[model samples]
Target: MSMDPVETFRIEAAELLEQVEQGLLDLTHRLTDKDLVDAVFRGLHTLKGSGAMFGFDDLAAFTHHCETAFDRVRKGEVPATVELVSAVLSARDHMRSLVEDEVTQTHRDAGAGLLADLRRAVESAQGKSSAPAPVDPAPVAATQDAPAPAAQAGWKLWFSLPANAMTNGSNPLALLAELGELGEMHVEADTSSVPPLDGLKPADLYVAWTVTLRTDQPRSAIDDVFIFVMDDMQLRIESLSAETEPRAPAEEIVAEAPSIAASADAPAAPSSIAPRAAAEPVAGSGDAKHGKSSESVRVPAERLDELMDRVGELVIAQSRLSQLASASTDLQLRSVSEEIERLSGELRDTMMVLRMVPVATLFGRFRRLVHDLARETGKAIELVTEGESTEVDKTVIERLADPLVHLVRNSIDHGLELPADREAAGKPRTGQIRLSARQAGGEVIINITDDGRGIDRERVRAKAVASGLLEADQQVGDHELLQFIFHPGFSTAQKVTNLSGRGVGMDVVKRTIESLRGTIDLTSTPGKGSEISLRIPLTVAIIDGLLVRVGDGRYVIPLAAVEECLELSLEDDLRSRGRSFISLRDKLVPFLRLRELFRTGTKPDPHQKIVVISTGSERVGLVVDQIIGDHQTVIKSMSKLHAAVNTFSGATILGDGTVALILDVGHLVAAGQQQEAQLRAAG
Candidate 1:
């Protein structure tokens, strides 16, 4: 991968934007939650700096405005109002759109709308509520719920450059240009710490600034200006109110409220809260007022994939060396082979870590989803997420978002009963959805569950039969009937609504899960809610694989799916000739011959091998001609021509430069179950 610094910044900026959006959404739940406020402020602040670093002048300028508003709230000059939160939330989306517009060479509204909204939100929180309210009634509650912030003294700003700030090429002048937006400013450069010009180090920053700003805007506006330089202490601030009244459209009413400008007993309140306004820049911060932080390092996704590709090659080279050493009597070759194998194994372990990402990133999106869904459905839904720190391959986590969204939406639309209906049924009015994830046995399990109206088996059966998906005389179990929901054109809604029931989304979820080589389980209990679960391999692009030969062609089975491998004995082979079944631990497990399935013409060997593979609850044995041992498979997606080739997930290159298809264990197990069904019918 090219080490393009610009691309690196782009990815980081996007992540920060998401964090800001989440913080904005969370504000509604915990209006006084200092952490969310700081989090949102920190995200916006970092975004502004990073945007400027990448020459995104407009982005940097716009985000600076938001950072300021959050800053005031943090310093206690203002409180978190629903109106303020909603305004910032909308502005956050606009900022993302702006970033994309810049990248795509499209029209840039120059962040004008977002900037205006941000200013309005800040102003309203400062006791001026008339800032550009939407014509629609959606935001009406938010406006009424927000209490204007208490007035403070004029804005006070302090900045301490990171000791080596100048060496890093950060310009203090830029911080100054934006701070000018907050009315009159008196900047006092702290040169007392500076050494004489002769004794001075050119790259060392010996100067800091303390600026006094006189402005009608809230103190947050000033804090926003210094968002980028915050950590370096290049900026610290305390705001106070001037004796004269600042005129606002809501000034006449805001004047009616007694203002809390300054308290002689608490001078540090404004300043301490000022720094704390930005979100958790600190790592592992339990104290809400003071956040945890560490220096951040950014890496490119392409670089990670490039590293994985190299590791794959190293694995193949080591495999060839291992084979050569096994066949040759040369001592030197054998020694080199052992050394290479050890090094490659260690490198692969390191590469896995590099490719891993915390699941918290994925979980963050649900906060907003739940919030919007609650607003739309007029249902009180509290989403509880667990195991947020679970880690998975970045690619796996990315593809799982859409399916999870649909599942949660389905739970809200049908699984969750209306509030009044729930209450009438002797249940709590508020519905709860639990999203949990954990790594188990080389795969990750994600569960979406709701405590609402459970799936109605009768309704499902009726829909299946009406849609010609089930026989009128069929007696499918409740769990089996639930699976029918994922069928194309299968829906059980009595009346179609905006959320669901057009017979769409579920099939797409099925298609996507299968594409990722993941399995979905539908479990339901009448009046006890339903749980839709997905079991996904940790990484789709790379897997630890067991390479084997069935005929002349080889296949790779995911190492995670291999339960056990056994050699076929004459007694066991003859006992199950017509039907393929292996007695493992006194339990009969069905087996499939891959050679016969592929229609490969080959004579049966004297002895064969059976590899036990499974997905979720089903178990199947794959009979092959030979055991080829373990290989690190670099998964390559099949071309569009092979997209419908459900039997195989993808193809990987072998050590001999030949391609071997990676078998999809879930698909094969299902096929085996179908075969068992056919045999039962014939019997």
Candidate 2:
């Protein structure tokens, strides 16, 4: 299906807004960075032009104001101030609403307010930079040996856009009008490239243009007119008055062209002018200019999800075929099954790589968030990110965004000390929050670390006791006590604030991470800092799982979490009946019997097996009746009836068409750890 052009514009506009916002945020650190200034200008300029082309009039008009503001900064008319950047940032958000939603009265009101603030910021910046504004230099003609002046110059230009430009929502007339605004100009259409009527495609643009323009604006301003279409078009600009010879007759130049449609203000032509070499493709506007056109295609995310679903179904069918071939004695059938299995496996791996996106895409948004949060909280915060290049499943990144936002907000609002308090505590005034990600086996570990006042264990304990989450004066480990912060309606703050402290976010964060079959670990020092580590599976769709049998039911353990398997003898099982612990390398690892846990009401197999699974540093053993070898598990979500059941994360179909529950490794490990803690406490 063809995508809606308006939707395409919205996507592109969203990306441009992100660039503009990032540029504005970076300007806070170095107000006079010329490169960043140019970048912000280009982003706003492109967004305005594209928005106009796609018929987003409001977006175009609003973004134009921002573009003009940055354009002044680029030309040194005004300095880049924090207030100016902040105003543009707010304007950038309103521009998003214009692109995304129907223009409502509320939106118009908000845009007006933002623009008013933007004007005030510009005035404030101008007041700070008292230098007299530079006067426009006279357009000067030069000989071949001397360089052209930086001021405006007379120019002759010829250009044609890509053939499909009009079909892709570009308006040649609008472009011409914009060029007309530059200064006095005469435009003539060159129809020599037009094909015969019998072979012509109406959607294709075959006409080119030749123009003679006299403008005080710099050459870059002229270039900006075609910024959106420069990549695939041909353009040549020449200094019309560079020659030392006398001027040519106007009639002679007009007669040289087969078809001439001149503007009303056409002036006498100069002597024969040689065109400057074709302009190199303008660069540094955005990622599109970085030669990605030939290397990548923009695909809808839902299409990828559909493709994944198809691949998963194929995997299940392949598994069934493999099982059938293994049972049969036909060697040819078995060979074909093995070949198909290999091919499907390779295809699955390729599909997964296609779906993996860098965490940088996820990390990039936080820069803006931190900027806004720092301003809101009146705190000095420096956000440091590492492992941005680390790749994770796209779906994981999408769902992980909200949870990470909550965690980072909590870190700033609850964990970090105020600037005054931090200094009083003999620490640096600026607190740091670091976001880092790395792949550990088949899991991605994301850590949010903050160098600020850590969580107050005593406060958490007091809250827990008052909320009845703990008995008063009860003994509890620090880790256990800190976990009370995640309980529903739990808060240590004395009063509610706009950012947090209403007792709402942390519980949602915990539930969200758990819903992804992920585990969160928290550690902190009283005065130093705190870090929260989230261990999440690399992918949620399909996994290499160890299928095992417990009583009459089968379960699949994620192969990534399965460290090793060991046989549990009848003698050892009988001896460890009450404690449910096994000795491995001189350490006791807690074990859970699936039969007992599920209440299968069946006797155990004489020689059962223990599949040792782990999440982060915690390990647990699942005692099963049989180890049924490896299987490719295409995870299917459990029904709503089973939504509250945390033991199994999902279910999968076996070769025999039986449904096998996929164990939630994170939940089981936490359970085992809790059991171990309880036993230790009882002793």
- What is the per-residue lDDT of model 1 for residues 1-683, given as tens digits with 9 covering 90 to 100? 45565666666678888878877877898898988888888888778877887788877877777777886777666677887887777777767776766443332453565567767767667675344432332123223422223334356555554555543435777777777766788887766666688988776656656677766565445555555544444233443432243333221111111111211122343234332222122111112112222234456677788888888778877877788788999999899899999999899888888788888888888888888788788899989999898889898888888888888999999988888988998889999999999899788888999888888888888888988988999766555677789899888888899888899989999888878888888887666688888888888766889999988899999999899999986666778878887788998788888988988898656688999988777788998889888888888888999878889999988766789999998889888877765665566
Task: Tell me the TM-score of model 1.
Answer: 0.76
Best by the lDDT measure: 2
lDDT of 2 by residue, 474-505 (tens): 88877778878888999999888987878997
Instruction: Give candidate 1's whole-model lDDT.
Output: 0.73
Off by over 4 Å in 1: 1-13, 38-79, 102-160, 163-170, 174-228, 234-296, 566-588, 639-641, 656-659
Best by TM-score: 2
Q: Note the Cα lDDT for every prediction shown.
A: 0.73, 0.82
